[model samples]
Target: MIGIENIIFLIVAALGIGLFVWQIRKIRKNVLLGRDVELADNPSERINKTLLVAFGQQKMFKRMLPAVLHLFVYVGFIVINIEVLEILIDGIFGTHRVLGFVGPLYSGLMALNEILAALVIIACVMFLWRRNVTKVPRLATGVEMRAWPKVDANIILVVEIVLMLALFVFNIADMKRVLLAGEEVVGLYPVSQFFVDIFGEDPEQLYIIAKVGWWFHILGILAFMNYLPSSKHFHIIMAFPNVYYSKLLPKGKFTTNPAITHEIKAMLDPSYQPPAPEVDAEGNPVMQRFGAKDVEDLTWKQLMDSYTCTECGRCTSVCPANLTGKLLSPRKIIMDTRDRMEEKGEHPAIFAPNHYKELGVERVETTDEKTLLRGYITPEELWACTTCNACVESCPVNIDQVSTIMDLRRYLVLEESAAPASLNAMFTNIENNGAPWAFPASDRFNWADELYVPSKN
Candidate 1:
């Protein structure tokens, strides 16, 4: 006894599931192209943590107004969709008017739906007002901001308002159908009955209006669903996964080995890999400076951090380098990583393969002028970093850039035998005296009680 709409529902349901599976696979595949992949130990624990952070909105609730407004929008939108279940029922039975046993239940659901739809419309307006008046920083610094986003957001707001308005209109139309058909509408839904009282007329015309409104509402939802994956609204689709796998990594957690404390001569001049961390007699590691010359030198997890950046420009806003007029923006660091990844895409159009291969590594070894000056980072900014945690700490997605800088610093000091002249004596003092000082060893150990040091093994 199923109707044409029921058959269509089955097809759409199957297609939706298939598409969802495909997208999950695509996301996982794309993840490898990012930097981090380690599961961080226990899968179940991490999953629970991710779900709590995401669903609880515990972190977001701290932000106040946006959280409350967004919560209403999220809740109301979900409530409006409850009618979709009734739609499917109507599709199967060739009518949605659930009477008899569950008549009161249907009435209550309809009333709740109407109220929630209106709330959703109200929330959309509040969001647009915030964007225009308060000027959300995300909207302001957006690199691609132009006619499209402004138009899109405002248009979406309009659409939500119209859709909510249509719901009430449809309800009134439906009430008229109930009246003309000589059937009692379970009176739990007050809004539609009120409209029928104030504006009752010929029921046939109202029936047509009901169908038109229903069409608009259904079509709008479907169009928005398809658009969700492609628009800025993609965040809605992506936030769960994005926040779920978010880095629990502490600030400045170096994905690359922090430093090779003492240098071991590589077997080949192009530096075929050597055994790591050649150590001295005291069991301390003896490895020369450590650093990454290019993209491959960084670990896969580091790349993930770059890819995860929401491009919210939160880092750029707080960047001391940008403030000081230096070319370095922490935001640009991840953006540059993204650019480099794109540049090396499967079939890159133009490539200068290793044309400037002699990185700070080769340059320091050869004392090459090209490497010393005008490298990826200027010496001034390199030295200027106060190890300030501002950029990384502020980043909502927790992209780490300072650690990359530190790795470069390690290479300069350890492997290349390159240090500013003033630092040479300091390095010498540390190297010869087992510490970075010209002061006597007794004085260094003086903080500990003399009795505590001498009698020790």
Candidate 2:
């Protein structure tokens, strides 16, 4: 008992779903290009963190007004989407208001939806005003926020406004149609009830308007879903898991790569037997590149952090290096990582079966002229970090921009022997004198002898 209209609805839904799945697969493949990392510890704590930050929007509340406005849009969007389920069911069955049989419950739900839709529209307008008129410095100042990013933010707000309006108009038209046919109002449309007078009492016209509004609202939702993967708004979906998998260590504690540590120890003690190279689940030795020369050298969690980044620029805004006029912007570091990853995803020459053959080489060459180190991010930017952890502390999603910077720095120092002159001098002092000072370790306590000390009571 499937009609042509029902078949068309099914086809459209299938296509939307298929496209979203394809995009998701592409993103997963891109994220998997990163090196393996273990962040499986502390499940209970991670869940709690996710609930507090992502679900509760705890970090966003630090700035009160914007957070409230965002909460409106966020809560509204989520609550309003509940009605989309009913829309889908009705579309497939070619039935009108199928959930209306729920008596008073349906009316309550309808009232709630209308109120939320109105709130969403108002919030979107306020957000647009804040971005365009007020020009919040944190949002507007960064180089990354230029061009497409600025437009993208505005575009999402406008689209949300349009969608909310469509929902309101659809309800108004539906009520008008019901009134024209002398039918009783079964559902409440609190906000849209005011619009009933605006939409006059022509049954045929109201029906057409209602149909158009219904189609636009659903179609807009589908388009928004697909748009997320390519937009900074991908944070909406990524924020939860990103917060859950966040680095649980103390902010200032640096994680030294074990492979590098073993090598250093072997160099220091000739009799020391370095531990065997760690093997993966597949029994293959996990290749340890001293530092990140490209995206693949970074850990998978780091790659995930790039996608999860909201590009809110809080990290960069608080970054001492950036604030002090150094070239390092923490936000730019994350954006570059994401950009390089996306570039690799698009080209995919590295993963091709006949990649070596195509390149006319013995082994497959993954890297080309471009690299994460010198190509996207410069050594100057890497060296500017004060290791203050301010960037990590400021990040809403807990993206570890500092770790990525340090990894690249490790590559420059260990593999390329490209440390800056001042650091090289310090390194030489450490190696020969057993400390950062040029003087021997025996003289380290010499200054203390000249100073007066208080006696313990």
All candidates' lDDT scores?
0.57, 0.82
Candidate 2 per-residue lDDT, tens place, 1-457, comes to 4689778888888888788888888888989998877888999999999988889888888778878888888888788877898888888988888889998999999998898888888898988888899987878875555566777788899999999988887889988898888899878999887779786777888999998898889888888888888777889888888898888889778777777678788999988899878898999997777888989999888888988987788898889999988878898788878878887764221211112223353222223447777766778888989989888887877788999999899999989999999999999999899998799888888887868779999
Which predicted model would earn the best TM-score? 2
- Candidate 1 C-alpha lDDT tens digits along 254-366: 45442322233342244556556656799899533246444444445454555555545556667776666555556545544433544443311222212123422332122
Q: RMSD of candidate 2 to the true fold?
A: 5.7
> Would you give me the overall lDDT of model 2?
0.82
Q: C-alpha displacement of 75 in model 1, angstroms?
A: 1.1
RMSD per model, one decimal: 9.8, 5.7
After superposition, the stretches of candidate 2 with alpha carbons farther than 4 Å from their true spots are: 268-271, 278-286, 347-368, 450-457
